[model samples]
Target: MSEGLEESHQLFGRVAEEYDAARPRYPEALYVALEEQSGMRLAGARVVDVGAGTGISTRGLLDRGARVAAVDRSDRMLSRLRARTACGALLADGNDLPFRDGAADLVTYAQSWHWLDPALSVAEAVRVTGPEGAVAAWWNTVDAGKADWLAAYQVRLAESCSGYVGPALPGWSMPPIAGVMAAAGLAVRETWIGWTRSVRLDDFLTDLRSRSYVARLNGHEVEELVNRERAEIGRVFADGRLTVPMRVYLATGRKSRPGGG
Candidate 1:
């Protein structure tokens, strides 16, 4: 990871509790989509969840009967994940997994792929999974275009947060997932699933504060931003409840069997 990216990971570790509480969980539809796209059943599948922060995705996988191993470079984040889930937590990076070849049925990155170098991480994921195994990477992002209030929030974020860039915040752009996976000899497919969540205004604000971009700000700056957001969002959500529009971007890359089927 680059210096800035490494620093952001450490910041996430420092606020692991807040992140676990505030970050949104992936919708169940996402897992169904993963199963359909990867042609892999979740029941009893061995999964390596790379960048498994706070066990959000890891827990989802476990609920579906997958035996998952949560891997992350942040010890604090892993500690929180371990406390919350039954999965084994490993302190490791995505580019270099400790597992032997074909050890896992699937390798997944949940909202954490951006932190990895795709060229190296993609290769590692392919190497770690068995024949016909798959690799999946996904992110849950705000669909600002779906709601006027969300659009305005994005504008405010761009104006106030130095790290903000469109809806992908923190990261300036989406990764070239298809190209990298194709280069690694995997068949890749992309899926976008739209979902919504209703949250209290305070909880929504807390989620914003937990974002790497906002969390990296100094205390005064973060407080100022949160205060402004409270007033602005309060005007829109008089009942103190917010309906957050979200979209899940998922890319599944499946390995071919020996016969290339």
Candidate 2:
């Protein structure tokens, strides 16, 4: 891994607690999207979650009855994962995966795709997913509405993460997922899902701190950012709770058959 990406991964490790508190899990709608696109049920599939930080994604698979093996480079994050979910957690890097060829029926990278060395990760994913299985990737970006305050918060989020990166790296500025899947010998396909979540202003602020961008801040900057966000929240909500919106995108593809690209 390159220095920047490696650095970003380490940053996430240091902030695992904040991460667990702040990051939002994929809505059940996400599972439906993957299930629909892959045409594979999770009950008996061997699912591999690459960059499975804190097992937020891994748990999603576990809930669906997947036999999950979650791989992450950070032991700190994986430890939290172990305590929270029954899925198998491996301390490993995405670039050099450990599973055997055709070992998995479904391989997923949920919200963590940006932290990977795409070219190598794609090759690794291809090698692990069985010939007729699927590779599904997902991410959650801030919703623009349902709360006047959250839209304002998005501005701050953009500032915090704007050139910021995590230990594995800055994740992808523009994720080359479909292309990577293609290069890895998969035919590309995708689905989109959108929804809103209700959260307190404090919870929303906690969510921001979970991002690598804000997580990398120094004491003063971090305080200032949180205070600024709180001020905005104060203006918008009297009871301290607010409804925030979200958009989720899921992309999936079948592993290339041996004789085809």
Candidate 3:
């Protein structure tokens, strides 16, 4: 990966607490879809969640009775994960996971794959996953161009931040995953699940701070942007809260089984 991309992954550590407090959680429907795709029930699956910052995704797997190992490169982020959950937290890179070959029934990357080189990360995933086991990656994006206020706020951010494409916002498309999985010798499947979350205005603002683009801002710029954004949000949402419509795009594929299909 480029230095800037690597730096963006590390940037979350600076606001680890806020990230844990504000980043959206994965909907249970998405997890169910993943389980279906992998043909592995969550209740007994041995899962490794790579780039599992702050235990958000790890906790979800654990909640469904999976035994999960949460892996991340940032000690600060891992510390937050450990504080919130009992899952094993491994400080490691996605490209170089510390797992025995074929040790995991399923390996996952949630909202973190952009930090990795897909070639290396997918290879590592394939190595750690048992025959017929799966690798899944997903991101929580806006469901549609439904939140105009949020759209305007993102525009403000784009205007302020250099070369910011706002991938976290609505309308930013992911590259084709079929070719990516094919290169790893896996058959890919894709799914989408829609969900909604409502948050207080302050929490909504803090969530923006967790983005690499926004986190790149200087303090003065952030404060000014927050003030402007808060007003825009207020104009659209009454009662000091906002409802966010979100869609999770899940791409999953299984490792080739021995004596393959």
Candidate 4:
């Protein structure tokens, strides 16, 4: 769709298992914002979940009773969603959605929109969503302050690890997001809340290695970089587990009403 997505998808494929294990789900407060402002009801409504990686966000929406068509370029990610209890999987991209105009009540992209070009994706999202529909995108950022040790570990991961920098910190580094949704003729709003998860060092490092930036590295170099991260993890989290702090940023926008766009 945009940027080095094929490579990113391949990288995700390589560590789908670890990605599933380490990635945290969206916070409930963010979901509450979606339910209130997204213009689509969560229960029993049809939703198209773009880049439904590991079914993480899909599961949340499903729990709200939304019937989700989980779509992603990564077969491994889609496979993960397929194995889940609820989800209809589709292999697709955000720039060229397969669904027809006005097909879905909600169109959502979670934690994967930056891998795509925003202008093109917003247009495509508007094209496929119903006039009354809404577009929602969210990213989970490592909060890095729930505990002292975890914050130090994140610094090591971002500074010393080869693959984890961009993926781990895109939430921190992306350009202005407030008006990105406005391009698609949708009004935008955003909110943030913190979350935490307990994860093993190896699983976390594998997930880091699954990033496109990491996969771009030579094998030995990638291993070496992650090894440094692992050593830091050991120094910081000698107990074999760490409570990872995360911040969920929820962005919601609604499709232009009939004849409005």
Q: Which candidate leads the pack in TM-score? A: 1
Q: What C-alpha lDDT values do all the predictions have? A: 0.88, 0.78, 0.83, 0.76
TM-score of 2: 0.89
lDDT of 1 at 70: 92
lDDT tens per residue, model 1, 1-261: 463654646978877888888889999999999999888999999999999989999999999999999999888888888887997899988889999999999999998887888799989999999987999999998898799989889888888877675663545555677788888988889989999988998888888888887877889999999999999999998999999899999999999733476
Model 3 compared with the native: what TM-score? 0.93
User: Runs in model 4 with CA error above 4 Å?
Assistant: 1-6, 145-151, 161-172, 175-177, 256-261
Q: Rank the candidates by TM-score, best first.
A: 1, 3, 2, 4
TM-score of each: 0.95, 0.89, 0.93, 0.85
| Residue 58 accuracy (lDDT) in model 3 | 94
> How many residue pairs clash in each candidate at the backbone level?
0, 14, 0, 1
Candidate 1 local lDDT, residue 259:
49
Q: Which stretches in model 3 have alpha-carbon errors above 4 Å? A: 3-6, 167-171, 175-177, 256-260
Residue-by-residue lDDT tens digits, candidate 4, 1-261: 334435567767877887787666677787788887775569988888888878988899999889888888899877877886466888888779998998888888888887777788777878878768888888877766566766666666667544454334656563344588876557887777777777787777876766666666778988898888888777878987866877777788876543465
State residue 6's C-alpha deviation in candidate 1, in Å: 4.8
Per residue, candidate 3 scores C-alpha lDDT tens digits across 90-136 of 99999999999999989999988877887889889989998868888
lDDT of 2 by residue, 1-261 (tens): 353544757888888888888678889989987887777888889999998988899998999889999999888999989987987789988888898999999889888776788788887887888878888888886555445555556655666655443222333233669878876667777766788777877877777676677776777887888898788777878788876677787888786443454
Best by lDDT: 1
Alpha-carbon lDDT of model 4 = 0.76
Residue pair clashes in candidate 3: none
